[model samples]
Target: MRKIASAFLALLLATLLGTAANPNPGYARVISAGHVEGVLPDGSAYVMDVPTNWNGTVLLYSHGYVPDGASNPARNAPSEAVRTALLDAGYAQIGSAYPETGWVVEGAMPAQLGTLNEFQARFGVARRTIAWGTSMGGMITTGFAERHGRFFDGTIAMCGLEQGSVANWNNALDTLFAIRTLLAPGSTAPLVRLPDQATAIASAAELTAALDVAQTSPQGRARIALAAALRNTPAWTNPAQPEPDANDHDTAQRNQFGALRQFLQTGLTWRQEAEAHASGNMSWNTGVDYARMLANSAIRKQVEAHYRQSGLSLRDDLAALAAAPRITADPAAVAYMIRNISFTGGLTTPMMSIHTTGDPQVPVQTEQAYAEAVTDAGRSRLLRQAYVHRAGHCTFTAGEMLAAVRTLEHRISTGQWPDTGPLTLNRLAEEWDPAATHDYVTYSPGPYPRPFHLHR
Candidate 1:
């Protein structure tokens, strides 16, 4: 009896060990999360976070621009939220701070893929790979899809800026000029006002001061007041609002001023060290240089010419002075942007792009240009679009988010691409309200209001 009992115990132990080794039949066990260093072909080191799971799908995530230098992708609240959501869905998440953030895609792609290779080696699983991102990440992913379409099974880009190339770049510069002209002080059709020029300058100064004060007093009322004050201004409204004109400038300006104020007050701030940590570059000199260059004469001539060609006049517009005309092609910068673009080839992967119709930071037309390009290239079958009818930056409702996730998962699991037939404006006014107006505004979709196109 004793011999028989010992044999039974040994068999049970072996069974338990086998179960531990194999765990879930359809999903890999949660392995670990750690930093992995990826080296680009150019020999630059990129640091990223890996959340291990064995679901047979590895996701490569690229982070957006870190203008203030914040580098840890894992630390961003939005990124953390998305990462958690994806991990819970049974994917191994690889988050990388790709090649010194500021829109440098050349070095970023290799570093991102290198990290993927490392994750694969560490886990020993030959899983399908997907690429995903928001804003700049979206841009980088699109760039990669355009060049390396075969690398990713699918891509999920949220509020990405897909406009590059000479034409798109020129359009972007024109929009910047318009914003400057509309927002500058002493302009009758100003997009926003701060009581006076001093106030405008003070608001920017106050933001820096509040950041300093908040470091010492995290919950200070002064910061709260500043935030509230900023929110009350007009410039803070949707950055994607229609351009200010003599007829609508007052209302738009008020809305924009309030919005800007609110953003500065409540937005996150990284002190000098924190910015340095995120950006990897310690100096704030790049931003300063960008600003100074905008003020230079040579650049102004290029900007003025571009504005004229776009059918916008610089004459008699105080806001025009804000235009940075000299923003020409920096070979290094363009090369970086191109690298990210080529890393993810376009229209080859199952992709769903959603953008707010009135996104200010990234113009809605940017997405349109991408979709048009895909269509023009005969790759429209692989892409679908959802447009939000709101005046916000990449803002989406919970329902929309869930819908997107479902569409993506369905494509990944069943190899069935979703249809693009249900495209419609996301918002509606009261039932009694008339049909939405279809004006010929910049970035508005439809035929021109008159014979000529409304150039941006």
Candidate 2:
């Protein structure tokens, strides 16, 4: 980093000398392994670490969604191992905890930038800066890259919901809607307009009880399959069990049930919080054609086979869904969600993303959807996506993530992408840490079942 102007240094000498009120004042070379922890101007707590052997590069990490109950100001990275590896590799790291949690993309985006500004003011600008995030952080990363590409040399997103906030809730509504209409027809499990957190919790528990009973009968299993398909949920919920065969409908239904047992409640609670943020319901199904949606779903085969196995007519379920009363979104609430964040694809920085092939929370198909958006924005060449053979959300080892980071760094250093085939990536990961098993694989995910994109 270039030296700060002498005049500017003199002006802040008193602060640097350390006043009684400000012991850890700014503008010093962080030569030794030291941590600078403080809250940003926006009240977001931030943490920064610089190694003795600085590599002239900084990694800006944006963490994933934390529910309100779990929100904290702890300054940390997504993973301890990854943070350690980055420091060991001589990369400075910085991140901030957003002021609010649970789908705070609007808040998170600025919080990250604020953290970066703090980093620049304390220490000089690094030669290179890389922005990376996971889950909702990934969404923030995508938007940040587009809006502030000059600030970063590259961007990396892992298991991210690149489809943005509006699409996320809309797709979730499809799954919850099907579950309510088909599984708990006589019961109350409002998919939207949740009165409060308690109501959402009760509804989720009620739906879960109905789900447990439905698992006993083939008829119920078939409907579960439909709901899962609508959300593009994978069939690999059990970490202990080996991955089921793609054509195995029985195992698929079982896995879907296992995931939804928790996901149903998760969706309800998250929607409740998100609705509270928007100040009204944001999901709707007024004009959606269930038959057409099921027909277009990537997991349609599983839904069809499960229905056939139960000796139930898939048409009947579709008809029932068609006849069910539809929900409409409040115009103001819809606007709030759209402004929460959306993508233009207008990617200026090189972006690398990795995902577990079977992530149930943020499905691999989101990668595909985001790729198309970038392609439409004429920025396809700036993006590269890879998948791990794991079976859960953000289940990547530190090695897997660094392998991707090295690949992007290579592109940054050489101005061209390296061979990112699964074989090549797996090799890179193994070299990073021979102890951690890497499962990079060549897989193509299908389109997201219910896509919602920004018109702009």
The candidate scoring highest on lDDT is 2
lDDT of each: 0.44, 0.82
Write the residue-wise lDDT of candidate 2 on 271-372 in tens digits: 998898899998788888888878777789999988888999999999999998888998888888877776777898999999998888898889888888
- Candidate 1 local lDDT, 1-456, one digit each (tens): 001134543553343333332222212223235444443333334343444444666666776656434444422113444556555556566755553544354445555655554456565544576777677677767765665556677777777766543233333333223333333323232112123334434444545444344324322322222222211121223645554543343344344434443444322221121222323211111111322333332124333433344454444332233333333333453343333342222466788777665454554556655665666667777777666555666565434443455566567678777543333222211111233332111233321101101122
The reply for model 1, stretches above 4 Å from the true place, is 1-53, 71-78, 165-169, 176-250, 256-346, 389-391, 397-399, 413-415, 419-456
Q: Which regions of candidate 2 fall more than 4 Å away from where they truly are?
A: 1-33
The per-residue C-alpha lDDT of model 2 at residue 314 equals 96
Give per-model TM-scores.
0.54, 0.91
Best by TM-score: 2
- Tell me the lDDT of model 1 at 290: 27
